[model samples]
Target: MQRYELAAVTGLDSLTRVERDVPRPGPGQVLIRTTAWSLNYRDLLVAGGRYGPPRAGCVPLSDGVGVIEEVGAGVTRVAVGDRVAGIFMQGWIAGDIPGDAGNTALGGAIDGMLSEYVVLSAEGVVKVPAHLTDAEAASLPCAAVTAWNALVRESGIRAGDTVVLLGTGGVSLIALQFAKLHGATTIVTSSSDAKLDIARRLGADHTVNYRAQPDWDRAVLDITNGRGADIVVEVGGPGTFDKSLAALRPGGHLPLIGVLTGVNGAVSTAAILRKHIRVHGIYVGSREMFDEMNRAIAASGLRPPVDRNFGFDDARAAYEHLERAAHAGKVTLTR
Candidate 1:
């Protein structure tokens, strides 16, 4: 088997490719031949030593789709030849997140999917949607699931309600699709007018250039006729959290999902108390959530956009591209 390992917490150069013997699946485990993988902003943080120090010699990527090559004893959930993707947290099957969930997270806590072959617990893998390509399915485990958990599972967004998305990253774009699928009006914010135009074509009811309008939250209030958005996908942590609170209607929902900005910042408990807002901290969800999301994706025929595809040998380049933050959607690597 061939794999890329993080030799050190340095930069893209830390990801080194090497060969090793493929390991067989244990009881209740499944071995898969990885076909495609996707990069996330978290991957960049891990590689750059910003997300926390990863284990030495860890395979670095959480999202991938592949074909099952073999199944171990007691594995009945899937069979050989089934196409599947591993859940972000192997231990989190349903309901509340368990205490050991962090230990089971791919890329950071354990060896991930950036390899020619990988073994995962059968319970931790979900069948990919039939209509999506391998690259598209590979994009789902982290980014798409976070978006689904925020809008569908946590917020319970409904028709005619307004939803605000913070940026044109993978999670935000997928949130736009999910919001529109549920009949909610979508408002997307981006620094580039070109990206805002693209968001409009993708069903965004309103677009705001945060660079042009520094107080973009005011724009959100105006668009919603002073009532404010019913739901806000708050991906920008401290830098934009206050504005996100101001842009939400009283008793609205704000699912805090990302820390693209710095981790620590001023938070207004007064506004939260005064407005009677509900703010939920979102992590990538469980396998059951992944299954439900796949069903909705299949029904809606929603294909996640792949901003660029790179060959397996160009893995380092792919990381650099994601670091540049120039992509409009998910970036993928194919074997």
Candidate 2:
């Protein structure tokens, strides 16, 4: 099987095309014929040594959707030809996240799906929602699931509540849909007006062009009639961290999902004290949460926003384009 690997810690420049024999599945495992994969900043970090090195020549991508070509003994949840996505955290199958969850995430500490074939435990592979195309389903494991878990699992967001999304990235966009699906009013911020318009079309009740108004958290306050939003999916790290608190209502939940901005910034303690906000850091969620979120997405006919697709062989180009493309959604690679 042909695959792409970050051969060394030399960054994307070191991504090399190679041929290797595809392995067969042992008992309780399944073999998936990879159809499509999506790239994320985590893949980039592992390649550039920002997230540390992997176990040699690692195939670097966690978000993929594939067809189950073969299943080993004892497999029951899915059968041959079932469309599935691999779990990023192989061992942490379900339940509330344990202290050491995600210790072996695909594309990082272990081999990943940026290849023609891969094998995973039967329980580690889950059926993709019936409605999604391979490209759209490929974006779920990393970005969308994280957003879903932050809102649904951790924050306990409810109908009639107001949710604030920090940016127009993949996670934020997906979270907006889930929030609206649960009957919560959503307010989204983006540096682009054009993208904000798109977000509005996607059911966002309030759109703040962050570029036009850098202090957009204040806009969240104004939009919620000065009560502030009940929750803020704060993706921006230091730059928006303090403002995320400001955007929240008293006793609001701020699920810190990611720091797309460079890490390092200070918090205003007075504001934290005054707002009585609860700040929580969120990683991509468990397989259980993934399944629950998929049910909601499927039932509601939620369409994942996919900005573009690149052919498998042009993997390097895919990474480069994602690095530069201010996509309103995800970029996918068809393998």
Candidate 3:
């Protein structure tokens, strides 16, 4: 088998491909043959030592889909030949995140799916929606699940509510789709007009080019006639946190999902208190959330946008594409 491991806590240069023997599953585990993988901004952060110091030889990807090639003793949740994707936190099955969930995160705390085959707990994987291609299913384990958690789980997003998406990245684009599915008015912001156009085609009710309109919060207010959005998918971290607060109506929801901008800065808390804004820090989601999200995708026939695809051997190029932020949606690798 072939796998890419982070040889040291350096940058992309540390991503080393090496040969390894395919390991077998243990009791209550399953062996998976990977069919597809997707790159998230977190992957770049992990690879570049921005997320944290990862374990040496950590396989660096949290999102991937594969088929069950074999099951260990007492396994029954999934069977051989079933297509499945590993959940982000293998320990988090349902309810609130466990304290030790971080230790179970793939690619960061443990070996991930950037290999020809992987062994995971049978309970840690969920069967993907059958309508999706392997690459599309691969995209769900991180970005899509996070979007679902923010909108469908955390925020009780209702019809006629307004949602402001920070960018056209994987999470934002998938959130846009989910927001539309729930009949909410969607406003998407992006630096690129081409990407904004893509968001529009994906059911965004309005678009803001942050590059053109730097004060986009006021634009959101203007779009809503001085009323503000009901939810702001806050992916920009401290760089855009204040503006996200400004764009939200009183008692609105803010799901803080990413730190695409710098992680730390002075953020005014007065607005949050004054406006009664509900803020939730989302860390991907649980396997139960994955199952619920898959049901929604299957029901609505939702197809997540794939910005680009690379051959499995071209993993470096895929990472470079994500690092450049050139994609408007998920960037994937397929066997």
| Highest-lDDT candidate | 3
Sliding window of 10 residues with minimal summed lDDT for model 2: 47-56
Q: Order the candidates by lDDT, highest first — what do you get? A: 3, 1, 2
lDDT for position 219 in model 1: 100
lDDT of 2 at 19: 93
Candidate 3 lDDT trough over 10 residues, lowest sum: 48-57
lDDT per residue for candidate 2 within 55-126, as digits (tens), equals 568888988889999989888888999999988787767876777656668888788899999988888877
* Number of clashing residue pairs, candidate 1: 0
Q: Output the better candidate (1/3) by lDDT.
A: 3
For residues 201-277, could you state the per-residue lDDT of candidate 3 as single tens digits?
99999999999999999999999999899999999999999999999999999999989888898988999999999
C-alpha lDDT score of every prediction, in listed order? 0.93, 0.85, 0.94
Supply candidate 1's per-residue lDDT for 277. 96
Count clashing residue pairs per candidate: 0, 0, 0
Q: Write the per-residue lDDT of candidate 1 for residues 1-335, one digit (tens) a residue.
A: 79999999787878999999998999999999999999999998888777755576889999989999999999999999999999999999999989888888999988899999999999989999999999999999999999999999999989988999998999999889999999999999999898888789889999999999989999999998899999999999999999999999999999999999988988999999999999998989999999999999999899998889999899999988888888888999999
Candidate 3 lDDT: 0.94
Q: How many backbone clashes are present in model 3? A: 0
lDDT of 2 at 158: 98
Residue 47, candidate 1: alpha-carbon lDDT = 86
